[model samples]
Target: MANSNPNTEALALGRGKRPKLDNETVCMRMSSEIRENLEQIAEQYGCVYGGKPWLAGLLRMIGSGELLVVPAPPAFNVKSAVKDRLKRKHSS
Candidate 1:
């Protein structure tokens, strides 16, 4: 006999959906650059949670400490490189 519940039928048919999660509203202002970066990470990782959008999953990873932040090394100075090249040219 077929189950009356649509969810059960879906499960039986191998098309079951993930259970929905209750999400709380978190409001904070972030710069457009930051938002874009997070969106990019989400897209890259295919992040999603409880049928939610990629952003939510990414945020969850960050909030749960699953994602560790590493400090980036200082950027190389192009001006210094140019000066070094000039010194080498002059010293040669």
Candidate 2:
């Protein structure tokens, strides 16, 4: 039976892998944005950076494909930073 709820179909998008290309796999316009974001993130992780990217690491996340081009989570240290600055100023 088909899914009755639209939400089910939306959530199930790309949940399964398509059959692997038998002859040769051809990638289309995958946008340079993907690579740029991936490289910046990989550099932050101290993963493969600068030199040629390691193939093994790429294989591990092939399931995510180019969608891994997400921006890094913002860091929050405001409270700690303020406390440390106050301490230094008072101590001086």
Candidate 3:
């Protein structure tokens, strides 16, 4: 038997239509910490259509000023970050 709901059926069949987007592809490099923070931000605020975070949508939101990208606070220290990572590594 098939799902009565088309959306559900499409999802079940792995046939969900990919949204059309611009042909241009953008890529950049960032530190692991920054990338992880970005992913966290996406998880928190980027799901407009699907339940999961959409990175492209998140970037759009940032570009549109719907989301604000702020620098870390004054007290944020690079040495402290390295130390924290080291602690986690040893703890594991």
Best by lDDT: 3
Worst 10 residues of 2 by lDDT: 54-63
* TM-score of model 3 (CA atoms): 0.48
> Tens-digit lDDT track for model 2 on 1-92?
97677676644676565656554444445445445444544555455735745333453455457426454446957457556755775599
Can you tell me which runs of candidate 2 are displaced by over 4 Å?
Answer: 1-29, 49-92
TM-score of each candidate? 0.46, 0.27, 0.48
Q: Against the hidden true structure, what lDDT does model 3 obtain?
A: 0.72
User: Relative to the true structure, how large is the alpha-carbon lDDT of every model?
Assistant: 0.68, 0.52, 0.72
* Shift of residue 34 alpha carbon in model 1, Å: 2.2
What's the lDDT for residue 53 in model 1?
44
lDDT of candidate 1 at residue 6, scale 0 to 100: 67
Local error of candidate 3 at residue 88 (angstroms): 8.6
